[model samples]
Target: MKIAILGDSLVAISTAHSLLDQETDAEVHLFTERPEIGLMNEGPGIFEKWPPCPNHWISDLKSQEPSEGSNSVRRSWFEKAIAIALSERGCIIHLRTRCTDVSSVHVEVKGAGRIGSGRIPFDIVSDMRSVSETSTEWSGGVCITGGEPKLEITGNRSDGTTELWWSGPRKDTGSWLQEMKWIGEDPRESLTSEIKVGIEIARTLVDTIIQKSPGHKIE
Candidate 1:
């Protein structure tokens, strides 16, 4: 199967990981507006469950530091690990690529460098980009170097600090939710629930693939 996942959000990474875990032969393509992953955010992060980039992707998961509750790989490592893992496994990573349009079976992207532009075809196209800024009641802020963390939302890192936001995507973001193919329910901790969301989407993809199989019957 071929899939085009929009965005480099952990959700997107997890979705790709989960899909490949279930369907090893699947062809996965990830398009991210960022030049790369890990550059988005830095430092310690907390996840209810750290989505493994799949055990085989990384030779030593322990080196990445996984823990439960208020625990995660340093943001940079986690981000890089998943992206690198996917890439090493043959998932085409399109960096600095912006999606210009989306359809049932294809995505049109405007990109930089090697990925000039194209309408890439896929068996499925999913938008896993975070809708925090667009789909929720929110406020943006910045956490300078040595600044006490006060906000729940965080953005990218720079010189000696990190940027944060006060709000996150919610279940109801009005028409904003319509901006993507699948935006699941947002939980108390947005990052935490994303793993399940990705897995669920993977199941949907698998089911769809099964149904699309020749000679398959729905009953």
Candidate 2:
């Protein structure tokens, strides 16, 4: 079976990995226009903490310290690590390419610049791109920030240090629960916990696609 996943977001990468882990014989392909994997180039980091699974990707991120200068550099390293891990898993990754169109049986893709275009046959296709339409007035700070889960720290000491306080959930940000599996009821929890939830959500989606489709050789 052949599967194609669009976008370079964490969810896309996770879905590819999950499919490969579950269905070793299936061919998983990732399509992205970016030169690298990750959404950092698009905006702020969506993954502020380690994801749930303690795989090589998570381990590589955990091995680094946060105080290592700019977060962009760290994020880049993390992204590269994930790409490497994905390649190791035998998932075909097509960088510098974008999926122009997708159907039940195939996907059309265009290469970077004048490189040309082609189509890839696939049994399943997963669109992992971020939704562009969002209303801040309807969701507050959460919607304004692309609905990325965050950990906000409050209360500060006089010495520039802050006291740890309980995290609070933003009331307007629960809309994602309707579409994705949330780790907990609150989004103000630790970033690591939220990331874990994201990973699980991606895994669940891939599992559903595999199970719901008959004669797919997903097992």
Please name the candidate that would achieve the greatest TM-score relative to the true structure.
Answer: 1
For model 1, residues 13-119, the per-residue Cα lDDT tens digits are 87887888888888999998887886455433335444533456443344445533223344556667767877887888898899999997999989994769988
lDDT of candidate 2 over 184-205, digit per residue (tens):
2332332344345446755775
Q: Candidate 1: lDDT of 120? A: 81
Error of 1 at 120 (Å): 1.7
Error of model 2, residue 112, in angstroms: 4.5
Looking at model 2, the pairs that clash are none
Cα lDDT computed for each candidate against the true fold: 0.63, 0.53
The all-Cα superposition gives candidate 2 an RMSD in Å to the true structure of 9.8
Where does candidate 2 stray beyond 4 Å? 39-51, 59-76, 112-116, 132-219
Once superposed on the true structure, which residue ranges of model 1 sit more than 4 Å away at CA? 42-44, 47-54, 57-70, 113-115, 133-191
The collision pairs in model 1 are none
